[model samples]
Target chain A: MDLNQTIRCIVKLGGAAITCKHELEKINEENLETVSSQLRQAMNLGSCSNKVIGMDWSKRDGVLDISSSLADFDDQRQFTVDFSRFVVVHGAGSFGHFQASKSGVHKGGLSQPLVKAGFVATRISVTTLNLEIVRALAREGIPSIGMSPYACGWSTSERNVASADLSGVTKAIDSGFIPVLHGDAVFDDRLGCTILSGDVIIRHLAEHLRPEYVVFLTDVSGVYDRPPTDPNAVLLREIAVDEDGKWSVVKPTPQSMNMQVEITVAAHDTTGGMVTKISEAALIAKLGIDVYIVNAATIHSLKALRGELRHNIPDDWLGTVIRFSR
Target chain B: MDLNQTIRCIVKLGGAAITCKHELEKINEENLETVSSQLRQAMNLGSCSNKVIGMDWSKRDGVLDISSSLADFDDQRQFTVDFSRFVVVHGAGSFGHFQASKSGVHKGGLSQPLVKAGFVATRISVTTLNLEIVRALAREGIPSIGMSPYACGWSTSERNVASADLSGVTKAIDSGFIPVLHGDAVFDDRLGCTILSGDVIIRHLAEHLRPEYVVFLTDVSGVYDRPPTDPNAVLLREIAVDEDGKWSVVKPTPQSMNMQVEITVAAHDTTGGMVTKISEAALIAKLGIDVYIVNAATIHSLKALRGELRHNIPDDWLGTVIRFSR
Candidate 1:
């Protein structure tokens, strides 16, 4: 089987969902714990489901040997096993944004000492958070290896990913280890240094790895018709994109279905906020991959992660599904 | 000045120096603390000495700017400021050796599930140590960034470094951030995966970065005529290499002078132990760079780090120096 085919999904833990964006380098511990528990349960379910489908395994010389019968298994059974493999990418959130904005690290002027300091500080902050998240996953019996984009020569040119070596990520996934990555301060050809947001990384991974699905776990229920705080705003349960890169509401039978999303960037968000996330989601969806945006702070998100959302749409499940229109 | 010229020295924190190599995953906290303190002091001294030599700096718009007068400073004074920049590469020691050896990760047959698990486990252990060391440096106000060579596409072929992208290391050095690397499990063209030792990394960096000197901190005082455990074994105060890469004892007037070094590897050490270190040191010396081996537990090692041993080797100092024969 192709290694890429084994990837079940690419999960994006939004900055606002996993961290207190308004604070400096503070993690939303409760949210992070809940999310981690959900991930563990989902992975455990995948393993259990695969076993239920009668996947054969034997041990020889202290090494696991998968029976050749696995290849002969029906496609439906093989698909069940794929859910065990996943990649996680997370945002910098409050960890790095404060320092990055203070020194304009995203704009990149490394010649100045402050910018250089900010670049280093931003990396230290984000990588520290990556380590924390990896530890959390490890505590739940998940083998996660933290891969820093900057350390692996991931860079951008004019705020676009020019180079990102995914060999490490693929190799780790193939070896049954989760590779956790995060937004980082990376070298940029045109700017000397710049920020690579988690959203952009997700789109790039979806384009390359081609996961079965993509999940965006944010703080809110889903994409709102207007600013989420507006009294008249409503959740858009489904969104569709046309070949021409146009979006329309697919659920709740929009009164006049003309999507004009109102996105706002927080004061400390060096990376474009909702705008980047929505645009990246649209791009990923255009690749014939379904992208789900849901509130991570709720139990319903666990259903999305467990691959249950594909078959059943619970009435109370408030989220947006961005898919390419056939 | 060239960025490379700013690097005063490359330091190797030997496995036996900072870690209890005989025990699994045990850190020599006292020794590590001493070493960290020495490093911090050396760096602080570098900054203070530069001020004494009349380097000028001014702050504008919250960024420090080095005055143009810095270039006009006499060669001797300019040299003092260069001492501030250095890189650190550490050995895996007790943290990874047990797992790597058990699974034969150094010999690498990643096809086996055991080997793959070992690779991931070894990385997790070593990276944990890297974080601890980085935090220690940070506590002392040193801007240290951990850069795992495996993550950056460093690989080996036939137990030799085949590819190591040093751009990240150089960029970090140029930007005034210390890049901390370590012996790690890396992909190998010949063996699927293998262990890259800190000694080999030190030699590679010395050849590429061309620092003024290199220091190797170990538990023992220095290289000996034989194993230090043997009673008649004498510590070789100095070793010299000819243009043809031949090593000869230069101090204490050897009885026969025909060097027949006896080296041993600890059972858990997957990477060649003393043998590899000496061979790499000789290779580095062949490049006309000086290498110092000293007991990190002693104050004399601090002198070596401060660049004071170059001019005045105290009578009480016990260490071996490897250098090209002029």
Candidate 2:
């Protein structure tokens, strides 16, 4: 099998991709296709690294949600499971936080910052759900599978281990497959359990895959210097996340303290996400990994680690970059 | 689709069926065939109950063995995904426990006994592994799926609703699909995070599903008069578990005092097990539900509750029925 030694990119389809809560399904679709194709084209031209794309969500593990998905028509919607170029990992936000609390380690201590009692199972639902959605996608021959703290190992406490059955993605990658991963609720030791978002999982891979760039594909066009809703808000070309959460990292527009960098990271309550992603990516950056926090919906704007463009776009309009340095 | 209606059975294939510490491949094919035939037969006989069988060591949740399952298959195969008939919660025992503990959770205490620091990732792995196994089983067209505690109304604490979907199992059951659950380590309210077992899950289900007969399928035949190791240990025809752990109603077996039911009543460190099964069955009996505690391995001599041949058996062999009139 010819495993490409060039730039390997692991694309994490944000949770927003599935819920479409306030986003449009068509928009989500177009962005994902563009992202997939761009990654695929780069890999094909030997211009990219190991390519992987994952579907991510935190609240879709409910039984009803999975059932309702049964009626979804096979098409790009099927791309979620295309194991060839993508390995999917999703979240389980809505499955049973109440039930988890009842039996979770994070018992009581509300308003006490972040509690991890039910987080492990919480994150796991994300990782497992991603696999299922991918399977649903696979039904259409999208060639997809997954590996998480549960399956392979994007673990929270210890060293990450590659799953023995890498064939799922190995074959796909050999055949130009795109592997996927997303934010997940993985089992945590200190606090019972925890969540591993698509951002972190992607960055985790960046540590090894050493992809040219890692992108956070969300619904927004890109990080705004200020709140998009606020006319006075400014946009950020790029920002950095201090491992200690001491610096200010803006998201184009800071909608709330949660949207911008804050004291405690999102890994605690799992709400303040950007800070967590930056911190995690910073760790990967020390290993020579660079990441891109972009509006995943705009795949045409993905860039290379060397600041090369994945798409033929005007330099002025290209999205921002967040490089990690030692 | 014409769904059949008749006497259907929910059978639990032992964990050994899917995962063996020694040779995993040995069990897969045989088990699949054996279970497939059994399910088909149960379906043809009656479909009302829904003949469902799932892997205790579900692929998604992973496995959790207190001890190493890497030894001989049956020697001390203590680890398996133990959940309810709805969700197959799994875990990777030795592999994950270390990882979870390393992540850190204070294990022991004074009055609470030695709190062996358990792994936190265990909670995540157990649930995810089980979910994956459920999906795997479902994909194989086993008409089975895994359930999470959130869907089963397991809320030890308040609030913190799970974002993941859980209604799939309810739908499957309503659609006549047999939902399977296993013992998973979920974040708990009281005990940081605790392990859940299939036995406990079934016990919990008895509170609802109220099956006419609750049978535990084990590797051994049935309750032995003496320890099976003694060769002279005769099989106890029946032993009833009373409401209070006091089986005063029936005459104790010859060596009854020495007989300790191997089960953990407390939910913290232990999962529901054989000892807990009887206790739970006692509750079921109170609801006028008849339960059969038999070693499923010896099911060749399986006796249906309605079978007439049982009339010829000795009263003791019939079972020490503990009536739950309350």
Candidate 3:
């Protein structure tokens, strides 16, 4: 898999999308499978540079070296679009948020012995959830390797991510494997340990890797003018980055509902909720990256994320699209 | 939990000790429970300086601020033996070996797509096993936080572990939480990805942390002159590191076996063999650190590793003790 030939993208599955966020540690297998399928489709529809013939990942001896003549024979055939590399990040959702909130781990004091224990409990729960996500992706033949933020991420005294060595993630992608990362408990200099949000991780990765697309797959359709639950709520078509590299919401027409900030569903999340996600997305958009906030629960929304609906979709797609204002 | 006041130790449970390495992915519940019990006993017996009362981790609101005067009053009491810090590392026996060996992951060279897929398979298997260990320890009232090496370990171009950020492990120990590490597949510049043995991890950690003691709990009694299956085979009680920092075997008695090199059971390990473990241990022993290899299957051996038999036992202990030549 040549890194240069890969159409790099980051697809972050919201905790609510793959796991039962309302239920502690319960995996939403159906939703997980759905998301995995869409990701597989995305992989098959992108450009794969190293699509070698006679390469069977399941068979031990099947990966034989192809002769030059055989390579020429393969080159004579037309190839389908397929992704050469991808990075998948998921939210902690029920697994981490429940324990983190209970322990106040998101608040980051971490001096008390009891709080430290809570940090352990939260880490265990979140990693367990990570296992499920990896399994689902594997079942879909994504070859997703689970990566932990705690192991590689270093946080400053203020409990912000100082550095995270994503070289492993880069290597996995270069090797034609999906690297699955999630919200996790990590070391903090001042606080003993703290939670690094998946949103923050995606934003940082998109800025560094400069992926062509960044997708946030959530339970809702997209960002709404008001809480989506409200009868008069209207979904926002787009949230754009200004020429000055500042974030601004598309002004609402009388047809759209009026609301200023993002209204995320009430959950155990301590990482500033949906508003934070939107803010992070906007930051990525300012870098000229196309960011999508879509409802993975519906197949249409997932297809939009995979660009399958790009040909026939209206300007107001199934989800909110964030890009540069011009 | 003051870092300076704590007594730290790293205890590694071999895959053969805690799980049925002979059986694919089958955990030896009986062995796991036994090891957990011994570890719990060891914790309670070690010196603990700050054992607080009225604290419960499961409860959300129980972590109240301790009155300053009350803390002073509580501080006046004599403290008993309890380990203040612990880091547990375990081997990936059945959980990883089968897939790793099949994928040739331990031998490195993951350029092949199939080998890269194998890396993911091995990580999932090892992490799954790690969860079992964490759950068992938690059931025994040990607050064990699962730490994935893939998250932190970085290998040099030569496939040697160049750096593993142990800040989280240190923080976990300092805060009185047990961080459980295991053999894992990590990113390597030379090989793309490679297996990191638990023994090597233990040695690297002991050198950096300089823990008071490091114990390896395995299925066998200790290092033997030959395979323990041989009817006439005998255990070599001790292997000493000379003053010159070189490893040397103690002369066998008339009743003991005379072989020098370590003889490990033939399993699916690709990260070298038993010889690798003994070599790594010898390196740590040369650093003036005490290293113990004992059969976790026997309570007596576990007790010996915990130093419970120190009062009545001879300088040469029941298990294989590796230390600098006296």
Interface RMSD of each: 10.9, 20.3, 7.4
In angstroms, the error of model 2 at B243 is: 5.5
TM-score of candidate 2 versus the correct structure, residues matched by position: 0.41
Ranking by lDDT: 1, 3, 2
| Candidate closest to the true structure, highest lDDT | 1
Instruction: Please state the error at residue B326 of candidate 2 in Å.
Output: 8.9
After superposition, the stretches of candidate 3 with alpha carbons farther than 4 Å from their true spots are: A1-7, A46-82, A156-159, A243-272, A307-316, B1-7, B46-82, B156-159, B243-273, B308-312, B315-317
Clashing pairs in 1: none
Of the candidates numbered 2 and 3, which has the greater TM-score value? Answer: 3
lDDT for B126 (candidate 2):
42
DockQ of 2: 0.03
Q: Which candidate achieves the best TM-score against the true structure?
A: 3
Per-candidate clashes come to 0, 144, 5
Whichever of 1 and 2 has more TM-score, that candidate is: 1
Q: Candidate 1 versus the native: TM-score?
A: 0.79
Q: lDDT winner between 1 and 3, please give it.
A: 1
